[model samples]
Target chain A: MTPFDTRGLKRRRFKDKIFTSIVWGLTFSCLLVVFIILFYIFKKGIGSINWALFTQGPKPVGELGGGISNAIVGSLMVVVVAALFAIPMGVSVGIYLADNRGKKWAERVAIAVDVLQGIPSIVIGIVIYIWIVKPVGSFSSLSGSVALAIMMLPPIIKNTEETLVLIPNTLKEASLGLGASYFKTTMKILLPTGIGGIFGGCIIGIARITGEVAPLLFTAFGNPAMVKSIFKPVDTVPKVIFAYASSPYDDWRRIAWGGSLILVVFIILLNAIIKLFERKWKVQF
Target chain B: MKNRWRILENKIFVRWLSISAILTMVLLLMFFLTLLVSSWPAIKANGFSFLWSKNWDPVNSHFGMLPFLIGTLITSFLALLISAPFSIAAALFLGEFYPKGVIPNIFRNVIDLLAAIPSVVYGFWGLYTIAPLISHLQQKMHLQASGLGIFTASIVLSIMLIPYSVSLIRQVISMTPTPLKEAAYALGSTRREVITKVIIPSNISGISAGFLLSLGRALGETMAVTILIGNAPELPHSIFSPSYTMASVIANEFTEAVDEIHTGSLIEIGLLLFVVTTIINLIGRLIIKRAIA
Candidate 1:
């Protein structure tokens, strides 16, 4: 190579090293922020998580000792109800989208799902308020679950569609060749084959809604007492955190911290499970 | 006889599943229609002036969404400005510098964890830790107002946006054709030069798609902003001034809105948020489509 070319190459190499170092620095800092946020929550919240914090309902104002048992139960009830309503519908839609790829109705449903996914959570709260809360004449846990179910649909649908679509068409062709009907093939073979991914999708959907507070703000409409009925208003972990943290009470804010910790842990665990499933299932064509 | 019955059962089952699938579209239409119908009362009352008017008084029966609209735009844009560069750089590091093995994998996992961190938890952290830290800095700078304002919210938002945008952009960058990068390196071009001259330029659409998607998310974000944005109703004079976003307003007021006008106006705000975020998301989706094409 010519001297000029060699010199130019050397200059570019030095510049690239500096630039690469800068990029590495940026990545390091970004990771640091994520860790800091997680560490901050754990540090601030750990002290607040006592045994009573799990066992009893929140105490009255100015009270020293209480827990988020009501919020815990309320959150679980809402999430379970949401999953029950959303999973079948979402999976069906996913099946439709993947099975009928490039079809007009499928395209329309896909667009609708995307738009629904993009709608602000607070707006869903309002729509559910008008749809269920007004018609039923009260804010209830049922309404909140419906709102969350709407929010949960997109994740489940998207994931299931992607998963099922990855199943080779030859599998379906073979099933048909063996005299299995379309419904029988899909239900018996396809769904089972993609069950891991579908389960991950459901978990993702559930995780997505677990900490959602805005939809429950006007829908479930937080209750101080733990009500056994889904038809009654309920206090969720997120709603409780929002309500307490905003107030001036010291103990309430600590309770909020405890609730935040629970929520963070729950989400992390759900995500980890999804990751494990994806790795373990490592599908090969 | 059993075989014929099975055939009929399969047909009926398929029909039922198809109906369930189509219900998604119907549900989405109903959601949009409900918002429009609910907001009609406020829309009719305010007319076009609602878009311009700054007054949001419920007692006096006046409502305008200007402050919230501006607040949402400013905070989201500010967040984008702070996060985009860092996300791009991180994407470059992961996609180009360390495409595999321990370091990149660790970074990827951390990003996923960040994405899974609940919005309320972020809000809690912002309210307790970041807000106090910002307030302390402001005190040192002798700035007026507490640190719980547009700036604090934007910082928190930027932090949240990084993991999301990085994941998207990194996917884009990593998917760049191998031959393209190889050709650049074959020409004595350095890694940075290959990234700037080849990979990023080729994948601009995907990068922008990621950016727009993140902007959409920041715009609709509620819990974090509601907790950190100070929830002041007035138009913000500065980043340090307390403000409210469209999402925050709906979140903060929808429950307490007693008057029909108040409720209607809040719903109207929700409608506006729905429309803006939908447009942004659609554009992002379109850009991703184009990138794939």
Candidate 2:
């Protein structure tokens, strides 16, 4: 290398320092923001959390030792119901699109899924609130679960179908040649093969729906206390947190942090589960 | 004869799954159609004037969506601008530079965790945490008390989009041919030069596509924008001025929308966002297909 060109590689130490500092600054600030958020939430929210917050109802005015039992039940109910509605339907549809790729309808269905995937969850909530809950004259968990189910469908369908499609056709033909029916072949061969991705899809679908507050806001109609049934109005953590945090009472605000922490934990745990499943079951199609 | 009936059962199973798939397709269509239909009233009533009208005064009968539209675009665009360079660099580093070791896995999982954080928590955290940091910057600069505005929202929104953009760009950069990099290095180019010329040029479309996808994400984002930017529907004179987004407007006011027009206008805002995203995705799909082929 020429000395002139080699000198081009060398610069003032200040320039090097500046470049180094900029890179460090960006990453460090990003890290700091994340750390600070968690710190604040834990600082404000953890003190109010206790076993009583789990066993009893939400705290009333000047009251203490009540629990998020209602919000917990409500959140769990909507999450489970949404999954039940979304998982089977989304997976089966994904299977058809992937396994039956040669069919005319599959391409059309794929486009349709993309459109569905694009629509916002809040819009879904608003539509159901207008058409379903408005006409039904009752705000119920059933409607909220349905909205959440609709919200959950596209992600599960997209990921599960994509995962299944990544499985080579040879496996399907081999299963078919063994006298396995299409349904049985899909069940035993395709689904199991893509089980990790399917699990990931389910985790994503669950995370997407569980945190949905806008849809539930209009349909589920947040009830601060414990819920009795899926057919009735109940409190979920997001809705509760939204309302309680903004209210006049400090206690409600404190509970909002607790609920926020709970919600964050649930989502993180779901994602962690997906990561574990992905590693444990790495069967390739 | 027994085998024929068994075949019939198998046929039924496949067909039934097909029907279920078809049902899902139908439901997806219904969502689009319903959003369009619900949003049509405001669109029809306003005509092209809706896009041009600036004032968003819901108190008066006159309500326009220009400011929200601009706010959404600006905040999201700003986010894409600030996040894109770092995201691309990070993606390349992860895909082509980072050692294939525990560190890569750790970094990858951290990215994944960022993606998993719930929108509401992000929102609240943006409000209480990020907003203050932003406002603190103003204090140090001796700016006004109200510096929590579009720029703040844009930065936070960019933070929200980082994982998606970085992962996508990383995958794209990694997918480039090894020979391309080797050729660049053989030419005696530095690593930076190789990335800028050989690596990025090869994957320019994908990187552009990532930004577009993220732009769409920033546009649709509601919770994060709501918390960081003080929700005043206006075209800010500068980035530090308050503004509202289309999604945040609907979110904040949907419940309290007293009249049908009010609700309809908000839904119309949603419809606009939907159309915008759909077009972006469709164009992206076409580009990706062309790029691959």
Candidate 3:
């Protein structure tokens, strides 16, 4: 090659190198922010995660040491109730969408699901307050579950639909060829085949709502004492974290840290389990 | 008898599926109607002037949403500005430079973890760590800073939104046809040239859709913004000035809004937020659909 061509080549190569380095630098900085946040949480929270954190109720104001057992139970109760309400309906919608892909009504439902997924959790809180809390004349865990259940439906329905869609149509055809009814075909064949993915979706939905604090703020309206009845207001982990972290007391802040750590750990575990499920139970078809 | 039973069960199952499918649309309609009905009092009280008036005195029974509207737009857009570059770079790194391997996988997983961290936890971290840092910086600069303001909240929000754009952009980038890249390379183009000229230009619609979706996320983000934005009611003079957003105001006051007008105004804000986010998301989804098609 001539010298002029060599000069142009060097210039382009240098530009490429500079651009590549910039991309790498920016990417690492983004990753660094993640690590910094993670490290900070673990450092601040490790000292507060003792046995009492899991076993005892919160101490009264001005007290030094207490746990978040009540919050833990409340979170479980709220999230479980949300899952129970969302899973069946979400999965049913999923099956319908998968079965009737191009139908006009099904298409509208699918779009509605997308829109519902995009609605802010805080708005859901307001709607539930007007619909359930105001009508019942009380903030209740049931209202909180309703709010969370709304948030949970999109993910669950999308996952189940996508999973069932991937299963070969031949399976359905063969099941019908065996003279099995549609209900029997769905229950005995389609559901079992897509159970892994459906369960993964449910877990993701649960994880999403578990970390949500907005809807619960006004609906489940926190209580200081542990409450057993779903009609009674309950204090959830996220809600408690919000309450305690904003308070002036150092002890409450510490309890909030403990609660934060518990939530982070639980969500991380849920995500890991999803990955495991995806890998181990991936259908070969 | 067995055949008859199977036929009846089949009919019931199909009917149930259709009803459940329709329930989703019903839920959406209910959300809009409930917000409208609840906010009617405020709409009647304030009328169209509520959209532009700056006054927000609750004691005087006056409520205007302009300041909150401006605050929400500022923070969400500022967050989008801050995160867009980092997300695009990270997406390119993962989708092009390292499409598959241990490193990319780990990076993807870490980003997902970032997304999973509870918003309240992020808010707490911002309150203690980021806010103090900002306060110290402001002190050194001799600026009036409570360390909690639009800028601080935007920083926290940018971090929270990065994972969303990164994941979406990476998917779009990876879906860029292999032949297109090969064609650019065959024409004696370098990797950077191919990216700038071929990949990005071709996939601009999808990339913007990713950003639009992330903007929607930032718009409705409640807990983190509430904790960090200092809850000021007035219009912010600068990024350092504290202000409130539509979502944060609802979160801060809805529970304790004793006055009928106060409660109505808060619900009005929720209605506005719902409409804005819904529009943004619909536009983003439309863009994504077109790009995919």
Q: Put down candidate 3 lDDT per residue, A78-148, tens digits, no spaces.
A: 99999999999999999999999989998899889988999999999999999999989999999999999
Tens-digit lDDT track of model 2 for A1-285: 554764555653445455445544554455555566667777877887878767777766787557688888898998898899989988988888887676788878877776666666677777787778878888889889999998788888878887988888889899999998887788788888888888888888998788778778778877866777887888888877766654677777777788888887788888888888877875553
The CAPRI category of model 3 is high
| Least accurate 10 contiguous residues by lDDT in model 2 chain A | A11-20
State each candidate's chain A TM-score.
Answer: 0.96, 0.89, 0.98
- Model 1 compared with the native: what TM-score? 0.97
Which candidate would rank higher by lDDT, 2 or 3?
Answer: 3
- Highest-TM-score candidate: 3
Q: Please give, for residues B76-165, the per-residue lDDT of candidate 3 as tens digits.
A: 999999999999999999999999999899998988888889999999999999899988888897888699999899999999998989
Fnat of the models, one by one? 0.81, 0.34, 0.89
Model 1 misplacement above 4 A: A5-10
Model 1 per-residue lDDT tens digits across residues A169-219: 899899999999988899998899898888999999999999899899989
The lDDT of each candidate is 0.89, 0.78, 0.92
Pairs in clash, predicted candidate 2: A53-A67, A70-A226
Q: TM-score of the candidate numbered 2?
A: 0.91
Instruction: Give the winner by TM-score: 2 or 3.
Output: 3
